[model samples]
Target chain A: MELITWPDERLRRVADVIDVFDKALREQASKLEAVMRAGPAAVGIAAPQVGWLQRLVIVDVTARKGTNNGLLILLNPEIVQWQGSVIGREGCLSVPEYTGNVVRAAELVIEAQDLYGESCRYEASGFEARVIQHELDHLDGLLFTDRIVSRRSDLFLRQGGA
Target chain B: MAEHWFMLTVVGRDRAGIVAQLAQTLFRAGADFGEASMLRLGGNFTIMLMVHFPAGEHSLAESIKAVAEHLQLRVHIDPIDSHLHENEAADVVVSISGADQAGIVAGVTTRLAAVGLDILNLDSTVAGSEASPVYVMRIEGRAREGIEALEPVIAELQREGLDAVLHPVDMLIA
Candidate 1:
């Protein structure tokens, strides 16, 4: 799967919601996982970023030291409930040039479907929650750059493998 | 369509509708707004913007000057190179905070330069009473050498009675 970069019109298109849970879906999820792991410090990836217009994302933050769930493969993921707010720095693969400080819901309840078409719901907080929200934005064609607190102060270039 | 771009800076005492008035003038001139930075420092509000106008129009600076005069604000406009682009992603975000003191910016920035890091963007403010103000600055920049090179600089700043931390800018998403 090819990773779509910024300025590509496909990156701006809202992805289609997944309805059928089949082998194709599983294969797509696996491909996304491989791409995410290929990066230096990637924890999450979205379908649109791989040139697929589907509401799918893969998140795994167990490698980092903190509170986290091992791995989450979400299809049509939705933030059912959220509370509080926290500001943190975020960088995206599609927008590889810069990182920005974005305010995100500190804790959230996300609902999605597993590979077997089984429903899954999870409660997450801290960096794990931030990764989910960042990936979810891709389903609606929104980027972290769009949610930056301030263009003049919040935005910066990612340096040294960022 | 032919277009011309200019960097405009305005500074004056803070007041209502200053932005609206300037925007109106630009609107009437058929100019488009680009990246802009506006802030209120003390009692003065300063604005800097990149404006694009259709080529062959009347002088944008002259028109803006008239509006600036009416609003009692100082304005400066200069032609800018539109081909310029933003720099690559920075390696770390450096934050510094302490009791307000003279030469804090100079001391910190100069130290950073010595380590081969460029200050891409910096925002600083002094809060609290005039007698005991607090200074806070957030700087983002790339390390020309590497992260290892910045460790000593951070330590030096800490020794100077300032709290400093350098955070790596990680690409969280693939």
Candidate 2:
């Protein structure tokens, strides 16, 4: 599965919700994980990012130091509740070469389906929560650039070799 | 054919509809807004925009001049070269905060320049009371040198009574 880059019409289209927990949904989830792991420094990826048009996302921050939540595979994830707010810098695989400061919920409670199709709820905070929000935006046809707090002073180009 | 790109800046006392008025004029003149930054600093509102005009519009400057006059704002327009240039990703994001003092911005930016780091985006605010203003600055920049090279600059900022910290900006998703 090839990761869709920015300005690709596929990235902007709202993804379809995953209702059937069948073999195809499981296969797509595996492909999303494979594509995300193939990229360097990628902690999370969504189904729409790979042109699947399904509500599936994978997040793993275990490789990153100072972060919790080893690995999470959320299907049809939704933010059930949230509180507080913090501004943090974010970059996306789809929108390469640029990063922006975005305001996100400091902590959030999310409900999603597991690989086995069982509904589960979890609370996440700090970097974990931030990653979840970033991936969730993809399901809604939103990019980090769309949520930049201040375009003039908040957006930046990634330096070479970064 | 390459597109014509120009930088437009508008600055004036804070008022409503400044953007709407200017945008209407630009739209009527066949210009597309690219990346833009608009903010309120102190009592003045400033807008810096990159605009793209159609290939054959040579009178865009004149039209913008008329709009500037009608809006009672200071405007500056300059043509930019039509070349595709990409900035390197920044390695660190620095935050500095302390009592407001003179030359803080100049002092910090100069040190960054000496270390071969290009400032990608900078935002500073003076808060607190009128008598005791606290200055805070957030800067994102790409380090041409290694991240360790910024240690001395951070130390110097602290010695000058400003608290400064630098963190690496990870772009792993790309």
Candidate 3:
């Protein structure tokens, strides 16, 4: 599946409410997984990147997890509660090759739906929390670049790495 | 189609209308300030911008030079190969523990900078233990080509009495 392009009006479109658990939805989820895997380093993907615009995202912080571990599939995810504030650099597969500092909740408990249509709750902190929140923003058609808080003199556009 | 993406940063004493003046320059040049995060650190204002233009048509260095001179600000601009992009880079974990001191970051980053390493996450903590204060730091970054030779740099850091470790991070594809 071809990833959606930037400034594609579709990217800004709020995802459709996905209220069903069916074979087709699962197929779409698989397609998102494929797209995420196709990138050099993609941790998660939302349905919108594949042009579906559904309120669904899949995040598995397993690779970067030190203790907290689980695959998170959030449908219609919402940041139900948050505390404190922190800044972290983030990059997105949909936006391709640019990373920026984004201000996000230091800790968040998100209420969302799973692929099985089951309600799920996630409490995340540090990198895991940041990644989940980043992908969830995509469900609302938001990008990491949209969340930056500083314009420092040291950020570089990288090139030519493995 | 060649698309050019550049990370542009401006840092200097905080004053009035710096963002306005700098943004004006970029807009006049037909380059899109794709993304930006900026804040005032102490009395200095810093900005990180992801700017883009169609590749094969213009040089990012020239654009950065024009903007830097016009805005009268310190600027650093580097070209991001469209192929390597953001997601294609390799991640490395770096942990550093040392006596509280300045230039610990500078010492480590200076070496990584020479090799085109991109820092992804950096955390530094200096804690008071009621006895001996401890300073510790950990960073995640992506390595460019020739970064494998940084073992010597790590060895040098170890000599500074700072415990340092560098390991490649394998990203799991979704």
Candidate 4:
């Protein structure tokens, strides 16, 4: 599936509330999981990335499984409580090839729905928690670029030619 | 495949060519890096790197001796195997950012001290406007023994108006 381009309008609108858990929705989520697994070192994916602005996300840290923390998905996610501020660098597939150091909550207790609309709660920390917060912000139409503390502090220009 | 682990330490006076010269020495001795953490505070350059190689490919003791002679830097190496590789420690990751102030580190470490946390690694940098610096700190270490439940105490520090976060280190895939 081709990535949704910037300014596609779908990226900005408040994503549609996922109200149904029918086969079509499940199929869409499966495609998202496939895309996420195939992408470069990504831990999460959102609907807007594929031009579907339904409140949905999927994440699995199983690629590094010895830590006993992996595989999570959030549909219509909402962060109910957050404590502490953390500064870390993040990269996005949508932005593609640019990374910025942005500050986010070190831990969060979030409420979200699953693909089947069953409610789930997530309490995460470290990089896993960061990934959740980053993707959820995308549902609200916010990108990491907006949360970046500064252009130079966390931003890096990847070397290409040299 | 032969596997060996060693705790390697490098300390020398701060200078521009230290890392380059050290890298050349390591390359010549054929030591592969397993994990590395380095810092420059005040005038001292301190380095701790975990290195590994095939079980019998090289003698770690002899390699350290050669690198020490070549680089003229204080270097120490200790060998360990599967039973004592120090795999059982927890880690705490802290992130802090605010309009830079002089007391940022003081405030953070003070809290950690009150909670009985022993910091193992810390990396911090400052950026932002010249007038107002944005200070960030990332810490990796095990939570202090017997004080694993102090996250809320740490959380309370947020009310003082600095962006602070503390959490257990999670799957560092890279």
Candidate 5:
């Protein structure tokens, strides 16, 4: 699946909830997971990023150094609780050539559904929580640029993948 | 007409409509710019921009003369070699804070250079009252190697009597 870049009208629209856990929806999840797994640098991907309007996301940080829940396929995820705040630099596939410092919850408890439509709650902190927050924001039509600490100082021109 | 890049700067006492006036003048003058930075320091406002203008005998100074005089602002425009430039990527975020002292910038920058780190961006300021003051500086720099080559930098900076911390660049997220 081709990822949608920034300024695309589709990326700005809120994604629709996945009410049906059918084969097509599962196939979409696999496509998103394949996209995430294909890139050596990518850690997460959202439904809107792949031109889908449904609420689905894939997050896997095992390739890098971090405490994670392995590969997670969250359907219609919601943040039940969040705590603390920390500013961290973030880069997005949709918004290429730039990275910005964004303030996110240092820790959060997310309630989401697995691909099988089973409810699951995960308490995440550190990098895992940051990836989840970044991916979830896409569902609401919010990019990291919208949450940057300061446009003048926080935004930077990306040199490499990082 | 041949297109040319020029570095433009406007400085004056902080007031309203400065940006609007400058922008309107530049727009009317047919000066196009894509990136610029403006900030207020010590009650004075300064603007720095790279303007793309068609090269001609008449100068930009003559074009903005009316607005500059009316606002009592200083303006300068110089030709640039090229508009396309490479921006440095930061490998780590560095923070330094301590009691206000002279040559802190020079000292820290010298140390960074010696360690082969190129500074991408930096902001420094002195805060507090007349009796006491604090110097705080934040820097984004490119490290030749990874964080392993960076850990020693903070140790030497702290030895010079300043609090320092270095954090690796944030992970790449999809």
Candidate 6:
């Protein structure tokens, strides 16, 4: 599937909460997984990114770097607690041409629902935490560009073909 | 009414209500602002704005001149192509800092141009005391061919006694 990249109005819409978890939602998650894997180095994907305006997100930092819960397909995830903050560079499949520095919680305890509609809690830190925060922003109609570290750091120069 | 785009520049001594004055004038003239950059250097405030004015009637220049004269600011308004884009994402961010010296901007930028880097934004200034000033510059630009092309530029800049570092746009993805 061609990923929806920048300036697409759909990416800016706040997602609806996932309700009535069922086989259909599971299939949608699976399709989203395929899209994520198909992307170049995409660690997480949100439902709104694929044009599904529901609060569903998939994150798998697994073995790539940092300690992680492997694969998490969360619906309506919420961060119950957070601690520490670190700035890291981030790019999105939705916003392909730009990467920016964003400050995120270094550690977090998130409450979420699994694909089977079971409540799950995870204590995540480091790279895994950053990926979750980045994906989570998509649910609220925010992008990495919106959260870039500073005004001085957010400079963009006009180009002929831009 | 069709949109007529213009790039407006205003430079004058820093004073209170400068931004409000410009905003009020634009609002009254029914002008929509696009991307803009405003900064105060030393004692002067400078503004660069992309203005979108409905062109069915009315003199945009005359309206702008009245406000500029009242504010006692030097003003330049130039028509821009309707297809003109606001900006492009910078592919590389380069920062260099060292003891203050002459020709730093010119020498470094000339090398950047020779290496095919199209600068989008650059800010350079002196820091520290008058006797021991440090020249620091941050540049955001596009390396059209590829970032790999910047390898030698970085090396050369480093060789010249300046601390230079390059960060590629795709350094991280999540």
Better-scoring candidate (DockQ), 1 or 4: 1
Measured on C-alpha atoms, candidate 2 has an lDDT of 0.80
Worst 10 residues of 3 chain B by lDDT: B81-90
Largest lDDT belongs to which candidate? 1
Interface RMSD of 1: 6.2
Interface RMSD of each: 6.2, 6.5, 8.4, 11.7, 6.2, 7.8
User: Pairing residues by index, what is the TM-score of model 1?
Assistant: 0.76
Write down the TM-score of every candidate.
0.76, 0.76, 0.56, 0.47, 0.89, 0.75
Q: Which pairs of residues clash in candidate 2, taking residues 3 or more apart in a chain or in different chains?
A: A41-B172, A158-B88, A158-B89, A159-B88, A159-B89, A159-B90, A160-B88, A160-B89
Q: How accurate is candidate 6 locally (lDDT)?
A: 0.80
Per-residue lDDT tens digits for candidate 4, residues B1-174, read 135767778887776777776766666677676556676864778888776655432476565565566556687777655332233333555566677777888878877767767766566777687787787676545566544655765676577777766654432211
Model 5 chain A — which ten-residue stretch has the worst lDDT? A153-162
Native contacts, share recovered per candidate: 0.45, 0.30, 0.25, 0.02, 0.55, 0.38
Error of 4 at B148 (Å): 28
DockQ of each: 0.35, 0.27, 0.18, 0.05, 0.40, 0.31
- Candidate 1 local lDDT, B1-174, one digit each (tens): 124778888999999989999999988978888778888998898999888875523478767778798888998777775543464566678888899988999999998888888877788888778899989888878888887798899998899888887876643554
Worst 10 residues of 1 chain B by lDDT: B81-90
Pick by lDDT: 1 or 3, better one: 1
Candidate achieving the largest TM-score:
5
Q: Report how large a share of the reference interface contacts model 6 reproduces.
A: 0.38
Docking tier of model 2: it is acceptable
Chain A TM-score of model 6 comes to 0.90
Error of 4 at A116 (Å): 1.7
Model 3, span A1-162: residue lDDT tens: 778867787888888888898888888788778787787667777888778888988777676747453777788889989987655556666775655556767788988877788888878886677777887777787877777664221221111010
- lDDT, candidate 2, B103-147, per-residue tens: 989989999889977887788899789999999887878888877
Model 2: interface root-mean-square deviation in Å: 6.5
Q: Between candidates 3 and 6, name the one with more favorable DockQ.
A: 6
Per-residue lDDT of candidate 6, residues B21-46 (tens digit): 98898879888887788999768999
Better of 3 and 6 by lDDT: 6
